[model samples]
Target: MHNSSQPRTDAPSAASEPVIEVRGLAKEYRVFDKPEGLMASVTGLFNRKSRVVEALRGVDLRVEKGEFVAMLGPNGAGKTTFLKLLSGIITPTRGSATVLGSVPWERTDDFRRRFALVMGQRNQLWWDLPAAESFRLHKEIYRIDTPRFERTRDELVDLLDVRKLLLRPVRDLSLGERMKLELVAALLHEPEVLFLDEPTIGLDVVAQHALHRFLAHVQAERQMTVILTTHYMKDVAALCKRLVVVTQGSILYDGSLEQIVDRFTSHKIVTLDLDAPPDRAAIDRLGFPCEIRGPQVILRIDRTRIADVLPGILRGQGVRDVSVEDVPLEEIVAEMFRSGSTAGTDGATGAPR
Candidate 1:
């Protein structure tokens, strides 16, 4: 039901261009204090008090043309707010952001045509009408030509496997199927930048995996710049190399996934399958507590202490099998959040620790 007013189109990028450039981006909301009762309501209209809620503190970020980046954070970590700033949905109270060579808040015709926003919970399509109608609406709003629109639409429909669901009312489709259609509608114009907020929020395990695979395929095929906000670590591990961890309106860590493990953890889980219960004193000498269950002994060993201690554990003839492994990414991220790492650090560079 809407269309962006534009003059002419421009050429695509060279793949090395910086698609998103942000500096000291911040947003704050003035939340008014309200009181109960009719008298309070009347007085509030004339002289109401309010408090400033800083949803996003001074944050700096840069995303390359085709890089897939994951923005990780707790429940209220300003991840969504950051996306709004970059996508031009809202204006920043302070700082500047340049997305695709234009200020996002300007909401220019060029920017609107080149990017798409897909929120998992928010339904942009009509509830009573079929998804096909929504796709048609998007085409009209974006001013896509007939041949180009059909080609892109059919290609996305085939790639996402949503051809059968096109005729069904959006309200009737299953969550997974509906989500696929949503992505189809978002990408019909072949956008260069995609801002995805919790795209796999409530889908089942199988559906979640399918959606992730489809996203990987779409990104690879189209070379789109993607900014994904997610709590799911599996998505980060599978699809994203650059992770930006945010907490309490601040960037705690901005680096590669490997570097996060290195900077945060210094120990590995060493499990021993004991032929018989080991002497308690043997488990005690490792300097860390051992989790004992019947005959198997689970030891957490510091990387440095492993060389000194492994020989002693193996010397015990009762040892059946010993396995050493790095701590899992889930556990590492949980540990980082446990420490309440909301204080600001240098994240603008998107560099390793």
Candidate 2:
């Protein structure tokens, strides 16, 4: 176990080398097709039909130490597949990846001791046993020193405020409580890399926020590298600065949230609160998509034309308030998922050319 009281002297010394690196990585599954009708099924038994489904394309990525990157995508987008490949849960069909200076599929004991994979939908603890028992098991499996194990477990339990729930059976705890314990279990060994797949799935807003705070605190303290796969935009916005959007077995966008919005969105949301209802003819002249709610007028205006257009709208009527904001991250991402276009994007950084 890592000694929490002292700084990690074992971290890679070269700052230029990424802790996680991938090139032309891909995965494919040969799924068999089954016939539906009884007669067809009987005939198909003699000759099976199968097709290859590409779960991940030839993707290239690099992540340095201590970076929290979030992978966002729709269903069947291969986000979980990438995480599994990196964590050594599954071998890739082609290409290569290295985590913490070792090939993940090799699954060396040294590498296994330095990383942890947590999937929200899967439970690592025994269902019938108390969480405390599971913690003891982890200590033994990891061969953690007694002092280090006790200190780490106590600190984590205190930080998450779940010391009281440790004695409860895993099956008895609520979803949120069990998640907290799961986190505690994963962290007990002080792994250098953490792979989280929808760790906040099915969690309430409060629970999500709590987990976010805990993750932020621990990452900062340990300088741990985390790669998260989650559908919750709130999780992406809250915990990760670097976002990678995947779709149709390929990366659609890879950059910061701000970069994604600026690249994909061409318009700004302008809302004006008028003292009186605006005239329809005048609103039409604005030449933008406009919606009127009571005395408030909302318009989606091109970013480049904002200077020329907004002055006219403000001067036209009794404008009590005017505000211009970028499109929400959620909307921009949804549009990317719908389009799945990589045009005008730099292959290296996913930035617009």
Candidate 3:
């Protein structure tokens, strides 16, 4: 849990500027026809057919010097491809993208020094070495001065609560500990921008929250720019104020999480537990769109009409306990994919009675 009252003092230096700017960026791959039979293979070497698959189509994005943004999408949504393009591991087939005002695909030493990319499924650290040794290797690789490297390493270990794990071998450490060490390695250079692809993928709840708090602190204190692609809704809800939702190889929505909820879903679910089983039929007769789950009854009411209807619903239904909450973000995201209408940032305009 975050100490909400604690004030964050981290801010970017005045010299720092928009670290990432992308426009009309796209990547496509060609698939060649393969001969299955030996007889067919003999002739296919001379003649073949192929088709193009677009991994990214006209993706445009911008990240300010100190902003934290979350990129949300289901699997096969081209999120990984976009990150790879930005990391300079793969070149884009079309358009332009700039990291710290330099095209990453160029693989310039200067551009490489300005950012770090961490893929959850990939490990940059040496498996047999202690995690601390990995950080030392990164310092040498990045050519950081001795004093600066030590300071940064100490700060990161303290912030991430991985001081004890750093001395352990990477293979022996727990999954969460390895992730923390991986993060330390990624940040030892203090790149201007950070790209995190599911950094908390396999972490337990406690580890997840700890990592989230540490990231929040980094963003607040260092003013480090971040672009995170994650499947966890809790990650988005806690760490990101803005989001870019992608699906089917295109950016579907780019805005605040609050706005996403407001536009896609208009109903708030209210759960009620009566002292005695209230007249279920009478409650059903009120017709406010409800579903009963054993001892609890859930009512969906328009956000606008919640106050107006709550009093009456409680009075007539003899409610004993009630709690109100927005519809799950997952359901809203699913609806967006199903509708196939990538236009509105606000939710649909239906009001529940």
Model 3 lDDT-worst window of ten: 1-10
lDDT of 3 by residue, 1-353 (tens): 00111111122224455677777788899998887998778777888778998777777776777889888777877788989999999999987888888988899998898789988888888999998888888888899999999999999999887888887889998888888888888988988789999999988999899889988987788888898999888999899987777765676666678877876687899999876665668778867888887667889888999999888877854577899999898887766555433322243311212
Each model's total of backbone clashes: 0, 0, 4
Screening candidate 2 with a backbone cut-off below 3 angstroms (N, C-alpha, C), the clashing residue pairs are: none
Per-residue lDDT for 1-353 in model 2, tens only? 01111211222234587888888888999999998999989989899999999888777777888989898888888889999999888999998999999999999999999999999999998899999999999999999999999999999999999999999999999999999999999999999999999999999999999999999999989999999999989999999888888776677676677777777888999999999888877887878999998888999999999998788888875999999999988988887776664421333223231
Alpha-carbon runs more than 4 Å astray in model 2: 1-15, 341-353
- Which whole-number lDDT from 0 to 100 does residue 323 have in model 2? 97
lDDT of each: 0.81, 0.85, 0.79
RMSD per candidate (Å) reads 7.2, 6.6, 6.8
lDDT of 2: 0.85
Q: lDDT value for candidate 1?
A: 0.81
lDDT of 3 at 54: 76
Considering lDDT, where higher is better, how would the candidates rank from best to worst?
A: 2, 1, 3
lDDT of 2 at 179: 91
Q: Please give each candidate's TM-score.
A: 0.87, 0.91, 0.85
Query: Candidate 2 vs candidate 3: which has greater lDDT?
Result: 2
